[model samples]
Target: MKTSIIIADDHPLILKGLNDFLLEKKYNVLASAVNGKEAFELIETHNPEIAILDIQMPFLTGLDIAKKCKELNWKTKIILITFEKDENIYNEAKNLGVYGYVLKEFALAEIEHCIDSVIKAMPYFSPELLSYLEVEETPKKLELLTPTELDILKLIAQNKTAKEIGELMFISNRTVEKHKSHIIKKLDLAPIQNSLLIWVKENQKHLE
Candidate 1:
């Protein structure tokens, strides 16, 4: 069966272009939504195999929709399309379990590969985004964070509680708290009140 998809973008031309291109590729385009609100409704109603959402949208951001899907345990996979090269945004998407991240300028050439990868339950990050990160200088404290610690921090930044983070990561709440403590110490923010959360907010731009 052809892979079914719902696409959401605020820009009409880009939305139509993507719709036309997917149809040309022989994929099933279930619906097109002009804004995030409509997109969420269409997704819940249709339950398409995949959702391609623009990062910025009216009423709801793509990340917002992704978070909602994660919360509801929706089966639909999400692919976020954005013009941002920010690491924080990318990390947040990763934490939210977004299957694909495609840059707008590279969409025409890379979108097919992205969709195919997501269908196979593999992640597909834009090559351009990866290349940008490769060249960017890593911050000292960020470098000290273990992969697991960084993942937990991203969840915390999204306001997920320890229990929620533990459930998502399949670890215990105590383990999550332990990791949080390590993160705070590693970042050298122990002196500040609510230091981890404060540091996450303050350094979010660099994290991105």
Candidate 2:
């Protein structure tokens, strides 16, 4: 059977372009959505094998829909198309069990590969996005953080509060704060006021 898919994007031209492209490729284009709400509704109704969602949309973001899908235990695999190359966003998508991450600029070239990988139950991230993240400084700094510290840093980058991180890691809030302090000192960001969060935001691309 042909792979059934639903495509969602806020832009009319892009949505039409993607729908046309997928139809030409002979995939079963079950539906197209103009926003995340519509996208989720179509997914719930059609139960398509794959969902291609733009990261930014009205009412609900693509990540929001992906999280909802996970919560509902939907089988529809999510492929997030976005202009964002932020590592923190990518990390969140991965954590939410997104099957594919395709940059909008590379969508035409990479979407087929992404779909194929997802069909095989594998994860796919755009090569262009990966290439942009291949910075030396980030890795060098990341090497200073221990595995536990790195985990906490990722949570911090996600904007998780100390209590949230503690609950997620099965630790106390005080321990989470201690880890944050160590992370700040190790990254040499303690000199600046409120630098840990700032540093995480600035260096997220490298940290990932």
Candidate 3:
């Protein structure tokens, strides 16, 4: 039998596009909703095997509906679609036992695979989202650095040479190099040539 699915998004175009795509794939789309309340209502009525929902919606968000489904002990699996790459939201979705998390930018390309994973009772999260989360977390890792390391990192970000940094800090070039090594170790950066300078250039904003 074809899989039964419910899809919801506040944006009409997104709703239409997703609904059309799913229909084209020959899945039985039980309903499409423009808001979270309507989507949850449809879910309750149709009892579909899967629900693909937008994270932001009027009345209730996708996470809200997922929470409700968990509370009701429903068998329906949820696949959330959103533009947000927020760590807190992602963690909350995991805590709610959400089956899939997809980014809107890649939704059309990824939804089919996401649904397949859901059918197999496996969790799926967008690779782009995961990469974004990793980049976002890199800043937080700066907390592992000491004040001296942070100052050195800031100087490195400013394109300072080891001799220049040493002169500015009243330290020797060797001490500056040692500090750079310590900074690299604390940040868990690769030991490749100019790797520290490359990292500083890429993450300069975090130094501020």
Q: In lDDT terms, which candidate is top?
A: 3
Question: Of 1 and 3, which scores higher on lDDT?
Answer: 3
Give candidate 3's error at residue 48 in angstroms: 0.4
CA displacement after TM-score superposition, residue 21 of candidate 3 (Å): 0.4
What TM-score against the true fold does each predicted structure earn? Answer: 0.66, 0.65, 0.65
Superposition TM-score, candidate 3 onto the true structure: 0.65
Candidate 1 per-residue C-alpha lDDT over 100-191 given as tens digits, one digit per residue, 9 for 90 to 100: 88999999899999899778665678878877865333367799999999899888767677899999999999999899888877876544
Q: Write the per-residue lDDT of candidate 2 for residues 1-208, one digit (tens) a residue.
A: 5799999999999999999999999999999999989999999999999999999999889999999998898999999999999988976776677888899998999999889977866567777776686522355778888999999988877767788899999999999989888877777653433356545655677657
Query: All models: lDDT?
Result: 0.85, 0.84, 0.86
* Model 2 alpha-carbon miss at residue 118, Å: 0.5
Global Cα lDDT for candidate 2: 0.84
Tell me the lDDT of candidate 1.
Answer: 0.85
Native-to-model Cα distance after best TM-score fit, residue 149 in candidate 2, in Å: 24
Off by over 4 Å in 2: 135-208
lDDT per residue (tens digit) for residues 35-154 in model 3: 999999999999999999999999999999999998899989899999999989987886677888999999999999989967865567887987787633368779988888899889
